[model samples]
Target: MGFFDRWRGREQRASIEDPRVPISSPNIITFLGLDAISASGETVTIDSAMGVPAVWAAVNFMSGTLAGLPLHVYRRTDEGRERVKGGLATILHDAVNDETSSFEWRKHCFDQAFTGGRAYSFIERSAGRKVTNLWPLDPTKTVVKRESGRKFYQYKDGSRTHRYDAAEIIDIPFMLKSDMLQHRSPILANKDIIGLAQAVTKYGAKFFQNGGVPPFVIEGPFQSPGAMTRAAEDLSAAVQKAAKDNRLALSLPAGHTLKQIGVDPEKSQLVELQRFIIEQIARIYSLPPTFLQDLTHGTFSNTEQQDLHFVKHTLKRWVEQFEQELNLKLFGRGNTRQYCEANVDGLLRGDFKTRMEGNARAIQTGQLTPNEARAMDNRKAMPNGDDLLIQGATVPLGTQPVMPVPANDNDEPKADAA
Candidate 1:
């Protein structure tokens, strides 16, 4: 069962009644907002002019969407509206609302030029050259002719002369948030898809120091998406209360006593005990998933600029695979995959699996099979023939391998007698 109905009325959330309605199994849409909340390092921002519709969307999300009260909104565009397909993906941007006041923003008003029509024209002649490749910056040179008094000084042959526009100033913005779409990097055409990418890419680009090498930092305007978390907490609380009234504990996992894992403290008897346990675990381990999903590949101009699929699936896979991987470490060695098995043999300490259950006595004692200790491991191993969709085909790997070569193995040893 879902956390809350997140509905305004009967017309809204009937489709999302199952939480997994439009999504695949093991996926809970209500958790998306929460997953986004928990994710770290990589983040995208949304800023727009005349944001009334956008603001309306945000408020709707906060009020009911994530609270398990599935409400209907336009998730997908065009003919898809008649059906309750997917809950329109809602991303919380703390600064999107306040962006208008911060900069010399550009805006498009419903002009008198479109007098008889309700829509703006897409056929208008453009100003700046169109930028096709958005990444690593465009190399096109925009020259400004020199003209005024002391506008820019030119120094040549040890002599300094007052000259105008002597220097060509290049502006490179891969990702950015600007009020004016025209001012945005990539010089937005429609100010919808490309614009959003410009802002996100510009902002995302800044976090990379020394040219996107290592240590990709999260450069934030760390605005909080209070609605997403608040909704989850409220729903959890409500469910908790219901459980308590019925005298039921959230779950009785091993090593936890009934008293320690007492009945929930919220107020919704409608939730299922199994669902509650999973949801709670999800809440607790939220960071290991959404925070890690990378939306670097897909772009605003790519797919209605909808990032929900990319972000949601990426996070879900990361969490599921990561959890299974951690479990594999508990068994350690013995018939594990070449890489996985080596990781557990008291070697490969740097692998993420090492951080999972390395110190557990069960793993150290070798009392369990690599697959048995972590029941989830078997599913996550390198895909065998049966699992591959295309038989006999192998997934490609980078020449730059995922695993590191030991420095000792890489070192050139001194010449010595055999």
Candidate 2:
């Protein structure tokens, strides 16, 4: 029996109705603000932060990469594990594809996980406790609450509240909280990084506005009040016009001086600062620096390693969370052996030549059989290919026989001839 079936039976036995309907209490949605305000006083919400290029790039890269992956269902039995087929696999692999839903399942998961560090979906069940449809929930409005050590989800929509038991709701969280019920948002944790990003943008703008020079002071000899005012205004107008016209020359009157005051962007290391910020953002998302297109320290060999690292470190974390959630909700907790998994090997696989060479080595070394290697290339197996083969010259260790001597007859004949 499924988790929902067990819960439903208990509820019926206790004569307690499921709280699917809204209560008579006032419909006041409690506000649990992130309080993520930058040092520059900019309110950093997911939407606003996404407007920043670095944040947008990182988030989009992660989401798009994860969305393109294929999720598979597998079953483990006494006969050994095999890819699952039929209803469950169909739902995970194809039914959740783009045609059945407004958005692709992967994309839906990406948006929720990236923005709020959590993704929620409802499993609509039929009369027989069979899943009829799956729909995403707005992570912003879905609240997780625990009472008497039992956790439930409450979704506030306009003036109504939709409640769901843990079995009916799919909650994929990025990282767990202390209570293990709510998730922690990445965006909220690193407001300082976002603030620094804002500063970098502001600095770049000012650099251009000042005609590629930092702020400076103009000192001139004493003059009549009217003359000084007129001279100052004239210099200001000329500099402003030059800036607009992209002119490098700024002609000033005699006794008037333009001394550049602030440190140049190069000398002040603004470029390095920007690069560092990119790396920091990448780190927060557990992505390699190259994934963010920051190749300051990237090399040919390191780039390949980092790609593998991305699949292993970054994508694996998210995929594992998804697998466990799919197993618990879709397959039910009763079936401990059957589970869903993301086919991360697609991302981890190497180029054709490299992969073929590695597989050849595996076969030659007796690590893999011929049919096993063929399966990786999507080719049909040949007869007798399942047998493991090793080079004929090689013998089993400690099993070589000693050759007997045949010199007795030769020795007697040679003795007579001498």
Candidate 3:
């Protein structure tokens, strides 16, 4: 049975009002938020996970970086490959539909993928089998099933259900389960770590919310429980009043003494713990610590290396996955001529000096025409700039330079000794 089907069955069973049913049942736990409770005792749902600054930064950095890139469709040709323009290319590079730009659509898709562990988009094609538009689908409402060696997507939308062939859906999963149809959510997989971060944040907030006072106990002699409770309330009022009045001294009765129950944030190493959690989050996303703005150990040289690492190790994998998925679903498995690719050159567009030097080297090595290099910088091409140029001073190692010979033997220079 599908997840929602099982959920409905549980709901129906829970509605029978049977006193024998345990409160710890799945439906009860889900309704009471117990299912979301993490090891640290913090509820770590998708929304709560995003509340952590480190997670927020990691997801936005990855998804936004991908969305900001330019995705283009290209065609294979005998003379290498050429970019395909218009039609599907326009949809991918400019706008997926009238309402959605390519960037927004890509960002939304990746946001879902990074958090929910899967993203889906519906490919709308014309009767002629040409793509016309791309529409985003909610991963939560969709279910994937395989039958007879073919996959199908069944999406529930309101009172209607839409079924689509696997070919019609663009599905990207963070990681597939054993069945290959269900996916493992990144947030769900590391809820303990995220929950710890959440718990620490809440602790810090509550600490400050109570005027920077830790939990404390009053040690005093009291004849009755009511007397002790009244004395505690009076002490609480005094502390709050002192804090509000900005007074340095907290006055208490002679017999009453406030004993702090827990260590201060500094003694508890909260700052270090937070930084460590940031590094853990970075690991979860395969990102460098610098990417998460945790530069405690970053130096200039390593920071530059981290930039390269991000493009090569982290971003390249995601870019390739997205490109392959696009190619497969949009063009089909048998397609060889048409494909999609993300222009990640923008990711390395760092300092102007560095970019200019790299472009110059490419031009001088005959790897790129002058005009092609100019296009990278958004500059107009110069006349005759289309020709590839190389340094004229260099020659092949084995070949000797040609020397001019005299037209006749008489024209040859004689040795001074002769």
Candidate 4:
């Protein structure tokens, strides 16, 4: 069947089987659910987890960094493959750039994939069977269910419901396991850390607001009826006024002794506790302690390596997931040769002098043509720049015999007398 026809069929089938609708059969029932809880009692969800600074930093940093990257599409041929444009490339590069920029779309995709373990986007096609636009779907409201070995998506958008087949949606799942149905969310896996972080944040806030006040016991020798009660009330009122107005003094009646109590903030080790919690939260998100502005263990040389580690160890997996999903779903089945790749060279690029030296070396070693190397620096190519030049001393690795050169006859003119 054609793409649109198959889509229509799936929609009709999904509508008929949709349990949300009122059907004559009494056995039918719809189970509306969303995965929003973790092992802890806290509500561990994408939005909630983002409230934690560490999580927000991790998600925002990754999404924004990846979105700024360039995702290029290439078509494979018998001889070689070349970068393609004006088809899938154009669609992905600025898909709905007028309303939703490509960077925003990519950021959303990465954010969803990282926090929820899956990201989804609805594919809009034109009458010519070309994908015209892409729209992100909230992973929380969208449900992925399988029936009769066929997987489909049911999305709840406000009052209306949208159904899409596997072909009509872009699914980027992270850490997909043997279930082959869904991916495990990193946020969910580290719910305890998130809860503790939030709890510590709340404690810190309360600590600052009430830190000046110290608990104490009021003792007096008043033996009259309601004397102790009246004294306690007056003392409470004075303390409250002092605390609320930031007063430095509190009056006490004669023969009354005030004993200070409660643990001090320093004695409680709140700073150390908070630091430990931040590091743990950072670890949960696969972020180095340094990235979260915790430079306790960071060094000058190690910082550069840490940045590289962030790109390679952490960000590469997310980038590859996006590339593979776009290649597979955007190009459709049987188009295995054509694929998309996010150019991450920008992230790994060095300083200007270092970059120029590396490019020059590449051109000299024939690894890249002069024109190609110049293009890397956004410089125009020169005449004959396309020619690949190699060092005169370098040749194929093999044994060769040297040949003798013949002498010119003009140099033997001195022997004419003989």
Best by TM-score: 3
lDDT of 2 by residue, 377-408 (tens): 77899999998877666679888777897667
Q: Candidate 3 lDDT, tens digit per residue, 1-418?
A: 9999887676555324555354446446544556578899887899999999999999999999999997888889998898889999999999999989999999999999999899999999999999999999999889898999888999999999999999999998999988889888888889899999999999999887667888898998888999999988887787777778877788667787889998888899999999999999999999999999999999999999999899999999999999999999999899989999999988657678888899999999999999999888789989999998898887788685878964785676677994
- Candidate 1 lDDT by residue in tens digits, 88-123: 111111110223210111011111101111111111
**Candidate 1 deviates by what RMSD?**
30.9
Residue-by-residue lDDT tens digits, candidate 4, 273-331: 87897788777667777888888878999988888788888888778777877877788
Whole-model lDDT values for every prediction: 0.28, 0.77, 0.89, 0.77
On the 0 to 100 scale, the lDDT of residue 19 in model 2 is 48
Consecutive 10-residue window with the lowest summed lDDT within model 2: 23-32
Estimate TM-scores for all models. Answer: 0.13, 0.78, 0.88, 0.78
Per-residue error for 374 in candidate 4, Å, reads 2.4
Model 2 lDDT, full chain set: 0.77
Task: State model 3's lDDT.
Answer: 0.89
Ten-residue segment with the worst summed lDDT in candidate 4? 25-34
At residue 354, give the lDDT of candidate 4: 69
Q: How many steric clashes between backbone atoms does each model show? A: 29, 0, 0, 0
